[model samples]
Structure formats: structure tokens, C-alpha cells
Target chain A: MDKVVKVAVDAMGGDYAPAQTVKGALEALEERKDIKIILVGQEKAINAELNGIGYDKDRLAIVHAEDVITNDEAPVMAIRRKKNSSIVVAMNLVKSGEADAFVSAGSTGAVLVGGQLIVGRIKGIDRPPLAPLIPTGNGVSLLIDCGANVDARPSHLVQFAKMGSVYMENVLGIKNPRVAIVNIGAEEEKGNMLVKETFPLLKNCNDINFIGSIEAREIPGGGADVIVCEAFVGNVILKLYEGLGSTLIGKIKAGLMSTTKSKIGALLCKPALKETLKSFDASRYGGAPMLGLNGLVVKSHGNSSSNEIKNSIIQCITFTEQNINDKIRMHLEEE
Target chain B: MDKVVKVAVDAMGGDYAPAQTVKGALEALEERKDIKIILVGQEKAINAELNGIGYDKDRLAIVHAEDVITNDEAPVMAIRRKKNSSIVVAMNLVKSGEADAFVSAGSTGAVLVGGQLIVGRIKGIDRPPLAPLIPTGNGVSLLIDCGANVDARPSHLVQFAKMGSVYMENVLGIKNPRVAIVNIGAEEEKGNMLVKETFPLLKNCNDINFIGSIEAREIPGGGADVIVCEAFVGNVILKLYEGLGSTLIGKIKAGLMSTTKSKIGALLCKPALKETLKSFDASRYGGAPMLGLNGLVVKSHGNSSSNEIKNSIIQCITFTEQNINDKIRMHLEEE
Candidate 1:
């Protein structure tokens, strides 16, 4: 029998919460027999959602938590006060080795805070970056330090490059993944003082394929496999990527709906267009992992659907089996 | 009779210099009878493009500038060493009070450096921000400090809001334009240190309509009239906005071309689709102006066509007529 990768899921987090989260966990069980899910939330609500779903009863379990965190609540304060909160309880499972990984579609602040304070960071890791895979023209590239570090030092960015490279190479299966620092210009000496400071350090590092500076324009062209920057810029890039994507798509749909002839054309082109668009969807890749943690902590989108949650949970199997933490440890602690 | 606006065109700057620059100048002269232009570049090259163009010769004149600045050259060094470079010569015309404004489609770095060093900043101004009008769902909004002032302070940002508001109100005819600081989250308390420190200052300032904070996701939906951020984050947003716009359009076009039926549909829908896409085309808004300068300096896109160049030149007329510098002085030096 294949070894089970236990995933402690935040059952009360995200928009859909108990319904979509419960459905996603069950779908994961149906897709793969080598996993078990411990749903952490209000037991009554979860059981109500899970009553009719047919699955191996022994594989799926629930750990009741009385409190739920809202998007508006302060993450650190909520985590401290609400010990039985789903996010806190779920993170504790990973900390105690009861689960190999933790997944949440909860408040990003709560997860980031809980992942650090509850699950703990690996030794020698200066900062654990929230690295998400953004879809590019050719493929996906990992955007490291998307939200975790602000006012990041050169050392922090250098570490982001290394950790990002390790994730891209092992998880995404990119060989000797090309890494680049996000900057305003392509030249070595260009960019703010932080980039100028980090450029040489990234260039001299022998372990990773450190390409020079990458402008934001080059990012969508799949210019580099691993894109590194401080949290401030990275967060802007990630959000704008989604914003512009939706805006253009909205414009295109309106364009198609403008004339009757184009409406017929839309009918003929819908399937192929959907397939092509799906290739560019970031959710197909799964949630952003909090790299450098002792085990694993993944933050899915707040409004994720069942498919996204299933993909998020499934990605944990690969992360756990590949030993990404061990690889990050080997790469970052080399000094 | 309307007062004549004198604009010194950098005839040697941009992708299609001498040719598109001369043509755009002629087009502007034809469009408005109350404007005169000084074309600065190699005399022979400027004359070659001007020989065939039919326009009022008195309205369009060429001033010979021997040296040319390339995009690859460093801004400060090139501005200093290339004594007779077109950018420098054209800027000198404004400094000498011969021309009201200077417009270029050449190197952005060169244009920014020349705007500060050559034309000089308005007295009492801390920093001159490069503010560009970006196309939005409703109309256009100004993005200040897109490329200038990377290591910006809160005081500089506060000025940017005031200056941006002044430009929007006078030039674009916007009334008390809403200004927002770019941040990771919308909450006042949530942001990088720069944003956190700057938020309350914006809230307290009674001059502009201060909307608390704007996430990158809200930008494309016409979230605010003046989106504020330091240069690093602003630059990323600007480039990423253009980059993602092109990428999605590319995907959608490919989607339409996948099948024969859709190909016919594309042919039928081409005109309406083009019209829809045209509204979101940022090039229609022309170039970014280096605000707070004594004389106007506008930087058009590097790869701009004649139409874009013409628009860039025409925009200077409105900016000069509105006396943007005088208003900037009043707003920023109010305290």
C-alpha cells in the first residue's frame, strides 16, 4: 500500500468554506487513495456537508474548532486569542507531525503569521517567502517574496532566489531553473539601491542559474523561471497580473458580444478559447507554499472553488513526497 | 487669436527619428494653426523627411543638433558628454525661454535626466515626478512618479498627490480627482512601511480627495483618478500593466484563429473588436510629462509611431496652456 500523506485543511476558511472545501477534500480522496484529510472547523457544519458524500470513512476525519477568522480580523491577534480557530488548529497538526502538510484558503495574514509562529521556520532561513507561480506566455514562473517580506535586505532577496529556484526545479521539474531579479531596467547597475546591492550577490552565487535583471515587461514573456523581488513589488505584480488579465478578458467578451456575426463566431471558438485560457490560469498550478517552513504551509486563493482546493491539496502530495523542505534546507543552509 | 504654443521637438530621439518626428510635427502644425515647432536633429536628416511634407514652413522650423543619444547610453553621462545631443539642444530651447515645451520618444532615462538637469525644477519643489495619463474604463487617470524618484520619501509622495491632482484638474478637467496610495491590502494599517507611513498623511491632507488605499487588483476597474506610489512600485505597475495587456490580447487573438469557423467570425467581428480594444490603448493618451519642471518635458513611448508622436506633441499644448508648473507651485508650496 502507498504511504498516506495526511493534510490538515482549514475547513472554516475562504469564501465557500465548509461546502466547497469539504467537496474538494472528498474529490482528492476519490482521485488518489494515498492521502487522508483531517478537516479542522466546526464539526456540526462539516458533518452536515459531508453527510451524503460516499467515500472511505476511515480516511477522512474532522477536528472541531470553535472559532473562525474573518478576512477583516487582525491575523496575529486572532491567532493568539482564538486557540481553537481553524487556521491555528490546522497549523498545530503540522507542527506536531500529525499531518505532513497544511492547506488554507483563509486570510493570508493569519496563515503567514500562523505558519511562522505555530509551524515555525526552518533553522538558517532568514525569512520564509510566499512564493506563487504566476502564468507566463510560455509556462509558469515562481514569483518569490510576493507578500512575506517588505523592506527586504539584499540577503533576504538572495535567499528568495535560492529558495525559489529549489521549488521550481524540484516541484515544477525545471532543470537548472533560470533565476532573475526583478528590476526597473535590464542593466546591472540600474534599479533602486536594494536591487543594485542584491545583483552581485545573486550573480556570484554558484548554486543557481542567476540571470541578470528582469523588467516587469519581460515577466509575462516567461523571461525567467524564477522571478525574485522584495514583497512590495512582487505583491503589486501578482495583483496587477490578475487585474489586467480579467480586464482584457472582460473587454474581449464584450467585443465578442457586440455583433450577431461575432456571437456565432464566439460559439465556434468558445471551446478552443477556453482550453487556451485554461493553460494560462494560475489556479491549475495550486496554492503558494510558505517556503523554508519546518514542514509545509500552503495558502490558496480566498475565493477558490472546489477544483482549486482539490488541486491545492493534491500539490501537497508532490511537495511532501519530494521533500522540498529538505531541499530548501540543503540549498539555503549551505553557507 | 489663440496664443501660440512653442514646442521644441527632439528630432533625433525615438525609434523612427527624423522621419516620424518630422511627420508628427507637420501633423501637429496642420491640426492646430496656433502652434510653432522647432525640430532639433541633424539638418540633412530633418530636411530629408520635411521636403515632401506639405505644411506652413513658417509654423515648422528645424534647429540642427549634431549628436544623437541612444537608448543604451547611460542617462547622466550621455547628457553631460553629448554636448550637442538633440535631447540637450532641444531642452536648452525651453531653458532659454525660446520654446514652451520639449517632447521626445527617445530614451526614457535620457529624457528624465535632461528634464531635471537641463530645464530645472520649479522653485520649492522637492522632486519632479514623471506623470503619465493611463487609459481607464471611464476615461484617463494620471500615474505620477512612474519612473522618477525611486527612493521617494513620504513628503515627496504627498507632493505627488498634490501635483497629480493639479494636473488632472487643470489639464484633464477633472474636479478634485481622487488620489489613492498603492498598497498590498486596502486597509490603512496594512501595507509596506512606506505605504503605512504615507496613508494617514494622505488622509489628513485636505487638498486632494484622498481615498484610503488601493490594491493593485482594483486598478484596472478605474479605482481612483490618481494612483500614488513610490517610483519602484509605480514603474512595476506601469510596465506590468502594458505587458499583461499585450499578453492577454495575444492569447485572445490566437483563440479566435484556432478554427475555420472562428476565423470567418473574426473577419466579421474585426471592426467592432478593434474599436473595443482601441479604448484601452494607452498610446492614445500620449507621453508622460516630467511635472514640477520650470518648462515642460514629455517622454513618449520608445517605440511610438507617428500618431503617438503627434499626440505627444499636442498634449504639450494643453499642459502649457494650463500653466501646469504655476499650479504645481501653488499646490506644493501651499504649506
Candidate 2:
């Protein structure tokens, strides 16, 4: 019998909650028999979506939660007040060791707050960063502290580089992953106060292979396997990356459909173009995992579809199995 | 006879110095007879590139500059010490009122420092920002303080909003241009300390059309005409925008060439695609202008070509003709 990697999923969160979340859970179960999902949300709503889906009843279970945390609500306040909310309940399951991981296609703030407050950070971990796997020209690179730690100090960024390295190496299977601090220029002396302070610290670190400064332009060319920065800079880069990718793709589509001659060209080129574009689709990689936590916490996009959720859940399996948190703790303790 | 706008050109600056700069000056004279260029660089090198170029010699003249500032040198120190360097000499023309503006495709740091230190800031201007006009979907938008004011305060961002508005409206002819402060999230409260502090101040001001917070994703889709942010965020977005644009274009070309059917499609679509792509080319928009200075100082890309140099020189004509600095001073004193 395969050992089950139990996942606690927030079913009442995200733009396409209950339906997409329930369907994604079912699909994940079908794809892998070595997993169990505890869906935490309104029982009636969840069962309505789950009805007639053929799967082992013992493997998939639903735990009823009375409330849903809306995106507009303050994350810390929501987590504190709404104890029975799906996100809070799901995180608690992971905290109690009832589940190995927690996945949510929900409010990023709520997930980040709940992950810290409920699931809790590992011992000696000062601050956990929300590290997302961004798609690059050659492959994916991990962008650490994308939205979590905005006012990060030099010490915090150093830890981000260390944690990000472990995740990229073990889970993503990049050997001796190249870690680079995000800066305005490639030169060590360039950048704002935070960057100038962090550069030498990162360069001097021996636990990871630290490349020098990486300007934002080099990011898409597969410049570094692990890109480290404070949350403010990281968030801007991540959002801009997504925005620019979609805008360009939209422009290309419009260009293809503009003329009759181009329409024929589009028809002939659709298959090849789709395959190439698929390679850059971020959802295929899964959700951003909040590192340095006692139990794994993953935050998916609010508008994620069934595939994204399934991929996110499956990603948790890899994270759990690889013992990423343990490695982070060990890496930190070596000082 | 049209009144000529005198622009001091840094002929020995940029990667294609002397050759492209001299050629571009001649081209600008050919395109616009109302502009006179004073080439500031080594006279021998400038004349060598200008030897065969046929133009009205009265509209083009060379003023010998003994040295050149390299990119690796510290900007402030270089500006003070290298008094006869091409960039410093060109800026001096603007400062002494011998030229209406100075244009350089040399080191960005040198250009920015020289613009402030030599040209000097307007009376009430706290800080002069390097505002670059970036290519967007429908048109171009001005990205203010891209690298100049990293530790910008709330007052600095407000001035950027005002200065950016004047540049977009008077220069780009954008009417009541929408101004937005770049933030991590679209919501009013979501962002780092700088954004949260600056948002409400912009909101209360009746001077410009202050659209609330804009996420980095909305920038490429022409979200706002005057996209305002502190230098660190602005720099990251600008570099990433250029990087991602090229990467996607490369991917699209690769996709079009993958198979025989797509190869024919590529041939059919090449003209239309090139025309569409040309609209988003950053060089066509000219160099970034250091706003709020006594005289205009435009910084073109280091890898600029003859066409970019021509466009940058021509852009100075508009800044001088429109009296942008006088308008900025007037706007500043009103408070």
C-alpha cells in the first residue's frame, strides 16, 4: 500500500471556490492513489459539487466550516475572528499534524497570515517568505519573498536566499542552484540600501552557490535558478512578469486575427504556438509555497482553475516528501 | 525663418559614440531645419565620423571635449573631476544658456548627476526625476524616477506626478493624463510603506487626474499615462518590461519557425507583425528626460543607434519649444 500524503484543502476560498476546488480534489485523487484530501468548507455546498463523482469514500472527506473569508477582509483580523472559516480550519489541520500540507486558491494575505499564525513558522525561522516559481525562457526560477516580507532587512534576505536554495535544489531538482539577489544593476555596489547591504552577505555565504547581482532584465533569460529580494521589489517584479506575459500574448493573438492572410497563418501555426506557450504557462508549476513553516502552506491564484489546484496539491506532496522545512532548519542552524 | 533650438550633443558618449552621434545629428538637421547641434567631444573623432555626411555646416558644429566618462566610473566624482569630458561639457552648454538642452547616450549615472549638479534644479523642485517614456499597448506612458530618486519621499512622488503630467500632456499631448502610483496590489491600502503613505496625498490633490493604486501588471496594458513610483520600483519595472518584451518576441519567432507550415505562416505574417512590434519599440519614444531641471537633460540608452539618437535630439526640440521647465516652475510656485 502506498503511504498517503494527506492534504487539507480550503474549499470555500478563491474566485472559483467549492466547485473548482472540489473538482480539483477529485481529479487529484484519480491521478494519484497515494494521497488523501480533507475538504474544509460548507458541507452542503461541497457535497453538492462532489455528488456522483466516483472515488473511494474513505480517501476523500469533508469537514464543515461555517464561514468564508472574503478577499476584502483584513487577513490577520479574518483569521483571528473566523476560527471556523475554511482557511483557518484547513491550516489548523496541518498545525495538528492531521495533514502534511494545506493548499488554498484564496486571498494571499489570509493564506500568508494563517500560514504564520496557525500552521506556525519553524523554530529559529525569523520570517517565512512566499516563494513562487516564475517561468523563464529556459525553465522556471524561484522568486523568494514575492509578497510576504516587505520590510525585510539584510539578515532576512540572506535567509530568503538560503530557504529559496533548498526549495529549488530539492523539490525542483536543480543541482547546485544559482542564487542571485535582485538589483537594479549587475554590479555589487549598485542598488538601494537593502540591496547594497545584502550583496556582500549573499556573496560571502558558502551554503549556497551565490551568483552576483541579477538585474531584472536578465531574469527571463534564465539568469538565475533562485532570485532573492525583499517582498516589495519581488512583488512588483512578479506582478509585472504576469502582466507583461498576458499583455504580449493578447497582442499576438490580436495580430494573428487582424487580417485574412494572417488568419490562415494562425490556423497553420496554432498547434506549434500553443505548445510553445504552454511551456511558459505558470499554472503548470503550481502555487507559491510559504517556506520556513512547520507544515507546508501553498497559496494559489484567486482565479485558479481545476488544473492549477490539482497541480498545487500535487506540489505539496513533493514538498512534504522531500522534507524541505527540515532542510531549511538544518541550513539555518549551521551558523 | 524658424527659431532654431540649440541642443548640445555628447558626441563621444554611448556605445556607438562619434559615428552614430554625428550621423544622427546630421539626420536630425535634415529632418528638422529648426534645430542646431553643437557636438561636444574630441574634435578629431567627431570630424572623422562627420567627414562624408552632407548637411548645412551652419546647423552642425563641433566643440572639442578632451575626455570621455566610462560607465564603470562613479557618476558624481566623474562629473566633478572630468570637467572636459563629453557629458560634462555638453551639460555646461545648457547651464551657461549656450544650448537649450543636452542629450547623452552615455552612462546613466553621469547624465543624471550632471543634469542636477550642472543644469541645476528649478526653484521649488525638491528632486529632479529621470522620467522615461515607455512603449505600451495603444501608446507610450512616462515612467518617472526610474533610477534617480531611490530614497524618494512622499513630496518627491507628488512632484513626479506633477512633472510627469506636464511632460505627458505638453510633450506627448496626452489630455488630463491619468496618473497612478505603482503598488504591489490594486487596493488603496495594499503596498509597502512608501505607497501607502503617498496614495492619499495624491488622492486629495486636485492638480492632476490621480487614479488610485495601479498594480505592476496593469502598466503594459496602458493603465495610466503618468505611472508614478519611487526609483527602486520604477527601475525594476522598466528593466523587467524591456527584458520580458524581448523574451516573448524571441519565443513567438521561435514558435513561428518550428515547422514547415508555420514557416510559410511566418513569411505571411512577418510584415504585419513587424509593423505591430515597431509601435512598442522603446527607442522610437526617445530617451528619458531629467525633469524639473533648469535646462533639459535627456539620457538615451547606452546601446542606442543612429535612429534613437535622432529621435532623442528631435525630442529636445519639443521640450524647449513647449517651455516645459517654465511651466513646471509656475506649477510648483502655485502652492
Chain A TM-score across all models, in listed order? 0.97, 0.98
**Candidate 1 colliding pairs:** none
Model 1 Cα displacement at B9 (Å)? 1.1
lDDT of 2 by residue, A26-62 (tens): 8899888889999999999998997887888888989
Estimate, for each residue in B162-244, the C-alpha lDDT of model 1 and write its tens digit: 99999889998988899999999878779988888888899989888998888888888789999998998888988887887
lDDT of 1: 0.89
User: lDDT, candidate 1, residue A161?
Assistant: 92
What TM-score should be assigned to candidate 1? 0.97
Model 2: CA > 4 A from native: none
Candidate 1 lDDT over residue span A92-198, tens digit each: 99999999999999999999999889999888888899999999888899999999888999999988998999999899899999999999988897899999999
* Docking quality category of candidate 1 according to DockQ thresholds: medium
Q: How much is the lDDT of residue A95 in candidate 2?
A: 91
